[model samples]
Target: MFGVTILGNNSAIPTLDRYPTAQIVTCNDQLLLIDCGEGTQLQIAKYRIKRGKLRYIFISHLHGDHYFGLIGLLNTLNLMGRVDPLSIYAPPELEQIIQIQMECSGTALRYEINFVPLMPGYTGVILEDKDLSVSCFPTQHRISCFGFSVELRKKKRKLIPDQAKAYEVPAAYYGKLQEGADYLRKDGLLVKNDWVTIPPEKGKRYVYCADTIYDVNLLPYLQDADVIYHETTYLHELEGRAAERFHSTSVQAASLAAAAHAKRLLIGHFSSMYTELDPFLEQTRPIFPNTDIAEEGVTFLV
Candidate 1:
């Protein structure tokens, strides 16, 4: 149930076939919007994503391609009579920006909006809920951009059904057993939680590199990530151009994934200049074999 669904994968421009940068990170029942590029709400509808599950919105930077659709999405949620509180994490300026829009339009939202400002060069855990934790780190982009790392925590322990049954533990109480609670028998004997269950396996991690130039310092945030979404705005031939724009090339993205030892790499944020996407994979696979294009509407399991 933990995965990322791409809403928009293109950079800057919204092409007829592709869109700007946006993604939905699904952590169990909760959904987090990673970016709200133009056409994001339509893409969410087009993909039939459960908008009601969206609890948080994260903006990497003020770049139009990264957050232009945020206001529209928020307004739509209000029009739909959504009363659930929504939390937004982004740069400090975004709060004022959203406030200005709401004031100018004389719009009052039906739901509560919590704005958490991310200061420049900030690197730390931003959110921790019952099911997931999210951390943000700085990225080398044209503006003050950030990359996010999401870890879906394993809360329940692994239960040994045979052992539990042998201990005369009722099946109805297995849920509590998996939660590390000791079982009390009818005869007053206590069965240790560890006797029937083991600690849960380590959690899986998904890292989103957002928009960045080739920088090795990012390895700390990406190390041992189960999946990483890194922007490949250009092919290897356009590496110079990518650097000039503070965007990354295919080869550079692959190199970062390889350096981080990520299990898989998802590359997107492609420049509109390239009509076809095969070259990106072709160039990346040699450097990191476990690389795939972050195609819109595709859900990548973390």
Candidate 2:
């Protein structure tokens, strides 16, 4: 089960009903947090999500709306006596900021915390564990921002039941066949692995374009993604303003999705000036019919 759950979707300011940017990506048994905006812990509780299951956190940039809640969340976790080690992947400056904050408060966390710094203007794979892989790429934000791509790989080969039975392969050997192992019969005949299994299916990918202007350079990272989350900070009417702020409009997000042929597009990071969200879908759907608003507390299956 690979999917992303939106916790906070608002842009800069936080309204009574809306929040800043934050999301949780569930890859099989592991949980990875994309951004930790303010009040993220409350949002987690609101959704009944298992916060303890979280193992990794990725911060896109130094924007306050993107990571203001990180320290608060860490404090709460330490207070709750969490002993499991946690790792955070973020820009190099974030480590010093976090360390200074912890130092001033004289707070010593019980669990080990590992900080992996992402250099400015750098884009490449950062982590790969089991079937889960995460990579970061540059985004066109005012700061040295990044976008993340999370992919879940299919490592096991597909078992062909008809071929396996035709080869007189025992049911007990099916597991080995899925693992791409040939079977040896008692009579000295060999049952080829290809006769019983096919190659693994393609991986599923979810790309989070944190904050960026309408730029085609992002297409390489977004190509053929199963699900994509792109910020739509304004309507097309404010396209110039969006460009000035280095943000994207709903129409731009839709166009990129159409270009990349992504399975689905999710639009969020809405500006506070807009009270209604229907216009976002109205503009995006005309270009990419599968576009959906990244509503808070909603989970999109990738």
User: Per-residue CA lDDT of candidate 1, range 124-181, in tens?
Assistant: 9999999699999999998899999999999999999999999999999999998999
Tens digit per residue, CA lDDT, model 2, 1-302: 89999999999998888899999999989999999999998898899888888999999999999999999999998998899999999999999998999999999999988999988888999999999999999998999999999999998999989989988999988998888899999899899898789999999999999999999999999999999999999999999999999999999999999999999999999999989999999999989999999999999999
Give the top-scoring candidate (TM-score). Answer: 2
Q: What TM-score goes with each of the models? A: 0.94, 0.97
Per-model C-alpha lDDT, please? Answer: 0.95, 0.94
- Candidate 2, backbone clash total: 0
Name the regions of candidate 2 deviating beyond 4 angstroms: none
| Model 2 worst lDDT run, 10 consecutive residues | 44-53
Candidate 2 TM-score versus the reference: 0.97
True-structure Cα RMSD, model 2: 1.2
Which lDDT value does model 1 have at 126?
99
